[model samples]
Target: MGDSVTSRALALLGAFDGENRSLCLTELARRAGIPLATAHRLVGELHRWGALAREPGGDYVIGRRIWQLGLLAPVQSGLTQAASPFLHDLYGTTLATVHLAVRDGLEVLYVERLAGHVSVPVVSRVGSRLPMHATGVGKVLLAYAPEEVRLEVLQNLTRITAYTVTQPARLLDQLRRVRAEGYATTGEEMSLGACSVAVPVRNGETVVAALGMVVPDLRRQLPRLVSALQVAAHGISRTLAGPASVEWK
Candidate 1:
C-alpha cells in the first residue's frame, strides 16, 4: 500500500488489541510506526469521528463508535443480536464470563462479552483477539471452520501454554470430537485455573460463531456449564438466515 495518512491511521487502530487496549500518543505513534505529529493528527480525527476516546488518564481507547460500527458488520451484528439475550440469561444463571466469538482469519475475535458476577475473571474483553487453539470458544469455532481455515490456523501455530493443542493430528481429532458433541471444553488450556466450555452457533449448516462461558473450577461444573452453552448456541443458530448459512442435513 502507498504511504497514505488514512492507511496509517487505520493501522494505528489495528495496533490496539486485548493486551494493549489503551495507549498514549507516544505508544500509539511508535506502535503504528508513524511520527508523533502524524499520529496526533490521525488520532484527533479518529476522536472526532468517535472511533477513539480519550481517557482521564490521557490514554486513548477504542470508543463506542468502533463498537457500534462492529455491530453494523452483517455477520457480527446478526450473531451478536441473536446471542445477547440468551447470553444474558446464561450469565444470570451461571455467573461466569460469557463470550461470543467469531473467527477472524487465524485468530478468534471476541465480538461480545457479558461478565458474569461470580465467574472466573477471564482475559477476554470485547474485541480481543486470542489464539485459536488455546481457548474453548476459539477451538469450537475452529473445529467447525472450513478445512482451509483450519489449515491456516495450524500453519500459524504458537505454543501458548503446555495445554494448548499444538500437534496437528491431535488438534484435528479434538475438532472432530467438538463437531460430534456439539460443544467444546478445556480445563486450564488457555489460562491456568480457568476452565471453559463452548458451543458452535450454526446458521443452518455453516458455523458462524462460538459462544462460551469461563469457570474458575472445572472438576464439578462440566454438566451444567455445557448444558447452558448448548442452549445459547442453539438459540443463536435459529436466529440466523440469508446466504451465509449451511443446510444441516
Candidate 2:
C-alpha cells in the first residue's frame, strides 16, 4: 500500500505541533517528508478549505475554522458545559487555583481553570498539556488510566522540578496510593511554591476527567481541600450523568 492523497495532506497537517505552530512551505515539506511540489499543492488545497492560513510572513498556521470546529467537539462542549457550574462553585468555596482536566494519551490536558487573585502562581492554562508525573490532576488521571498508558508514562517520567517524581518505581507506588485514597496530591512537583490536590470526575462508571486545585501549600489544609474538591467533583459527575444520576437530595 502507498500513501494516499488524504494521507499526504494529513501528514502535512500533522507536521505542526505544540512547538512548531507555523511553517513555511519548505519547512512543511521537509517535516511532512513530502516533495516540495506535492506539499505546495496540498497546502494550497488545505488553505482553500480553511484548514490552514498564511500569515503576512508567508508561514502557514492553523486557521480559525479549526478552532471553531474544535469547540464543537463533544469533549470540549459537553464536558465544559456540565462542569462549568461546579467549577465556579469550587473556585468560590476555595479561592484557590481550580482546574478541570482530562487525559490525552500520556499527558494531562487542562480544559478549564479558575484562579483567585492571591492563589499560587501555576504554569498551566486552558488547553495546555503537562507531564503526568508533575501535576495532581495528571496523577489522578494516570492512576486510573489504561495499563498501556500507565506503563508508557512510568517509563518516560521527566523531572519538571526538584520535587517531581523521576523514579518510575516511586511513581508506581504513588499511583497505587492515589487509587487507594480516591485522590492525588503533589507538593511543588510542577513548580516551586505550588502544591496541589485532585480527585477523579466520573461519568457513571468511567472516570472522564479530573478536578483539582493548586495552593501555596497543602500541609495544613489537605483535608478541607479534599472534601471541597470531592463535593464539587460529585456535582460535576451528576451533571454529566444526565437523567440517570442518583438522587442524593
Candidate 3:
C-alpha cells in the first residue's frame, strides 16, 4: 500500500541521534527527505500528540511524552522494580556504573542504570540505545537474542572500533562461549580505557535482559569485577525464574 506519508513526519522524529539531541524543522526535513509542506503537516501532528516539542526558536525536539511512555514500559517499571535495589547496592558497594538492558530490535536499550558518585563515565542513560557488537550488555543481549535477530545483526555489522568483533562465525562462537561461561567481558570495545562484564537475566528459558558493570582499568579490576557482576546477575536470575524460556534460535 502506497500510503501518503509525509517526510515531515519522518523528519520530526528522525532528528534524534547519539550526537544530535535536537534540531530545527529545516534540519529535520532535510534529513528526512521530505518537502517543507509535508514537513509542516507531520510536525503539527507530532506536536499535537506530544511526540515533539516546539522550542523558542521554532525547533522541534523529542518530547517528554515519549520518555513518560517509556517509564510505563514493563522493561522499565517491572524489570527495574527487581533490578534497582540490586543495582544501587552494587554501585554503592563497588563504585561502578551498573546497567540493565534488553535486546530491542537489533540494538540494546538501556532500561535501568545506577552509578556511584565517582566512577568511570558511560554514554548510556535510561533510554539510550547501543549496537550489539560494541558494549558488554550488547554482547550479552546478542548472545541470547533470537536467531533471526542474530542473523540480521551479523549481516549489518558496523565495526565501531579495532576491538569490535566483526566476523560472524567468530561472534557466533563467542555467543556460545558466553552461554557456556554464564557471563561476558569486553575490553575497550565500546570506548577506550573502559572494560565491562555482563551476565544474563532469565525468565524461565528466555533471557529478557542483561546486567553489566563498567570498570576503567581492565587489566587490574577484571577479576573482582567479573565476580561481582556474576553475583549480581545470578541474583537477578534467581528472582526471575533462573533462566529464560526463549530458545537461542
Candidate 4:
C-alpha cells in the first residue's frame, strides 16, 4: 500500500534523533524520504500543532508538545513515577544530583533527574541520551546489556573527557567489575570535576534501569553513595514488580 498522511508526518518527526536534534527543511525532507513540498506542508502542520518548533536560526527541532506527549508513554511514565520519590529521597540525603536511566540501544536514556545545589558539572538532562561507556549509569547499563550491544559500543568508545575509557580491553574490565560488584563508578570520565556511582535497578531477575548519583568526588564517600543508590534501586524494583505497577517497556 502507498504511504499514508499519518505515516509521512510521522517520518518527518522520526528524522530527529539523539544526534540530529535540529535540521533545516531540506535536510528534514531528505531524511524523511519525502518531497520537499510535502515536507514543507507537513512541517507547517506539525509546527502549528506544537509538535515542532523553529530555532532562532530557522532550523526545526522537536517541540515541547512532543515531550509532553512522551511523558505520557507507558515506558517513561511508569519508570519515572516508580523512581521519583526514591530519587528525591536520595538527593535529599546526599545533596547530590540523582539520575534514573535505562538502556536505549547502545546509549543510556535519562528518564528522571534531581539536580542538587552542589556545583558538580552534570551535562545530562531528563530526556538526554548519552554514550554507554563514559558515564556511571551508562557503564551499569552497558555491563548488563546483551553481548552484541556491548561489542558494538566497544568498537567506538569516543572519548568525551581525558579520563574516558576508550580502550576496549580496559572498558571490558570495568564492565566485569560493574557486574561483579553490583555497582559502577566513573571518575571525571564524562565531565571534569565530577564523579558518579550507580547501581542497577532490577525488576524480578532482569535489570530494567540504573540509579545513579553525580558528585564532586567519590573518593571518601563511594561506599556510602553506592549503598544509598542500591537502596533506592531496590525500592523502585519492588514498585515495578508490584501488581499496581504500570508498564515500563
Tell me each candidate's RMSD, in Å, in order.
4.7, 3.8, 5.3, 3.9
Write candidate 1's Cα lDDT for 63-157 as tens digits: 99998887689756567767778888998888788889999988899889998445575878787789989899999999888889899888866
- Flag regions of model 1 displaced more than 4 Å: 15-28, 36-67, 219-221, 242-249
In order of appearance, the predictions have TM-scores of 0.81, 0.86, 0.79, 0.83
Off by over 4 Å in 3: 1-11, 152-158, 218-223, 238-249
Instruction: Return the lDDT, model 2, position 183.
Output: 97
Mark the regions of model 2 whose C-alpha exceeds 4 Å error after superposition.
Answer: 116-119, 244-249
User: After best superposition, candidate 1 residue 44: deviation in angstroms?
Assistant: 4.5
Model 2, 183: alpha-carbon shift in Å? 1.4
Q: What number of clashing residue pairs does each candidate have, in the order they appear? A: 1, 0, 8, 0
Tens digit of per-residue lDDT, candidate 4, span 1-249: 336999999999999987899999999999989999999999999999999999999999999999899878976778888988899899889999899999998899988899956558899987789998999999999999999999999999998999999999999999999999999999999999989999999989988899999989889988888899889999999998888876547
Q: In terms of TM-score, which candidate is stronger, 3 or 4?
A: 4
Query: Candidate 2: RMSD over Cα atoms?
Result: 3.8
lDDT of 3 by residue, 122-229 (tens): 878877899988888898999888889899999977887788888888888888999898878787888777788898887667889999988886677777777877
Cα error, residue 157 of model 4, in Å, equals 1.6
Superposed by TM-score, candidate 4 places the C-alpha of residue 97 at a distance from the truth, in angstroms, of 0.7
lDDT of each: 0.84, 0.91, 0.79, 0.92
TM-score computed on alpha carbons, candidate 3? 0.79
Per-residue lDDT of 135-239 in model 2, one digit per residue for the tens? 999999999999999999888888888889999999999999999999999999999999999999999899999999999988998999999999999998888
Q: Show model 4 residue runs off by greater than 4 Å.
A: 1-7, 14-36, 47-65, 246-249
